[model samples]
Target: MARQNTVHAAAAVLVVVPTYNERENLATLAPRILAQGEQFHLLVVDDDSPDGTGPLADELAAADPRVRVLHRASKGGLGPAYIAGLTTGMKRGFDYLVTMDADHSHDPADLPRLLAATHDARADVALGSRWTAGGSTRGWPLRRRVLSRGGSAYVRLVLGVDLRDATAGFKCIRASALAALEIDTIGSSGYAFNIELNYRATLRGFRIVEVPIVFTERITGASKMSGRIVAEALLRVPALRTTSLRPLADVRPLADARPT
Candidate 1:
């Protein structure tokens, strides 16, 4: 753990937030994340949010050098947006990269704890887990809670990964670990992407740690969850379990990208 601390003491961190019609949330979340400290940078990847979220992101980036935005042509999916952002972060030489919900569901205040876990545990990835000890959720309906918990359990059983919250979205990953994944080839584009990435990291022998956090349901915008997204996840879990890890050299180089 001490080794990690020393290695990343002055490391640059990029928090990649994928957004879709989250203008209201970003109005507040962006400032809060920037306030975390100078060591962290914020990247908002907007999937052509029709609600003018992409323009808002540009305004934020223009106002602060620490903030940047990535504009996509259409609403592809969460996984691809993150892959694009992570690839951008890696190419730009960031030492650590994080992914979290753009909505207020993920508290910006808890980011420090996740970063601390990354250093303290010497972990290649730190998951903000609601299922781990000291973790909890707020404002979620009973049915949603049940589904999330059940989903994690099923993923663990199917993937044989020991993680408590395989579907957790808030996480910090060492750039080295991310680069090792050959992220461009990742197939899952829904919630299952979280499980697939975690499982892949485990197979690559990287240390993964969980940090407890309270996940609150978003108060604004609409939830992206849908029947099709859930079904895609269920179908992808078995495919991930059977796929072999790709070699680093085989990973296609991602083009350099910037805020649009």
Candidate 2:
């Protein structure tokens, strides 16, 4: 699964995928992500999976220059893992930073379209939307479909994020937008992180576009969705609406964001 060339130091794009005990998925996922294009580099931020996902990712990184691994001490929540990943991308001066799931629910093939959507629309964030026209899900249970739809709808209504799939995990974010939003300051530590990211970006008037993508249920391993995660998102959405999110700058013009 090794590619001939290493990721260039000045490569413009980086995809940060967070993993926890996703060894089965990682072995199959890394090569596909790398195959997307030569311009893309991948960073696997593993939460020190006791399942040995960390070592597996390290082996992949060793074989391929485009692949890199970030080993965290424990299974921190999705937000912290992503925060660390995005922060690393920005520090390395990448122009684009993308986030994805290691579960293969998010298609690696859709990666380019996300980046392209951001570029074509001059948007700061591109969401891989399952509710948008042309988007679909394969093998997803009806309950999950309902939960995702209802939750995102709630997020949209309460937080004013103007996207059909505001809670989507797959996304491509422009580095400039990351710095502008000050993503590090976001406080949510659970799955609500997706909504929080979009909400903050919208508040800052950053352009967010949706590209229809097919989300598939994993064929291997256990799903991470849990009661606590759902509750966290449910509790966090209203707080985001009521709480005041300070901007990176004291005086910045708020753009009136509308659905696209």
Give a tens-digit lDDT track for model 2, residues 1-260: 12322323234689999999899999999899888778789999999899999999999999988888999999999999999999998998888999999999999888777766665456678888898777889998898899889987898788756677879889998888889777888888888898888888877766677788999999999988889988999998898876565342111111222324
lDDT of each: 0.83, 0.81
lDDT of 2 at 171: 90
Give the CA lDDT, 0 to 100, for residue 101 in model 2. 94
lDDT of 1 by residue, 7-116 (tens): 54586889999999999999999998877766679999999999999999999999999999999999999999999999999999998899999888888877766676
- Highest lDDT, which number? 1
Q: Model 1, which residues run further than 4 Å from truth?
A: 1-9, 245-260
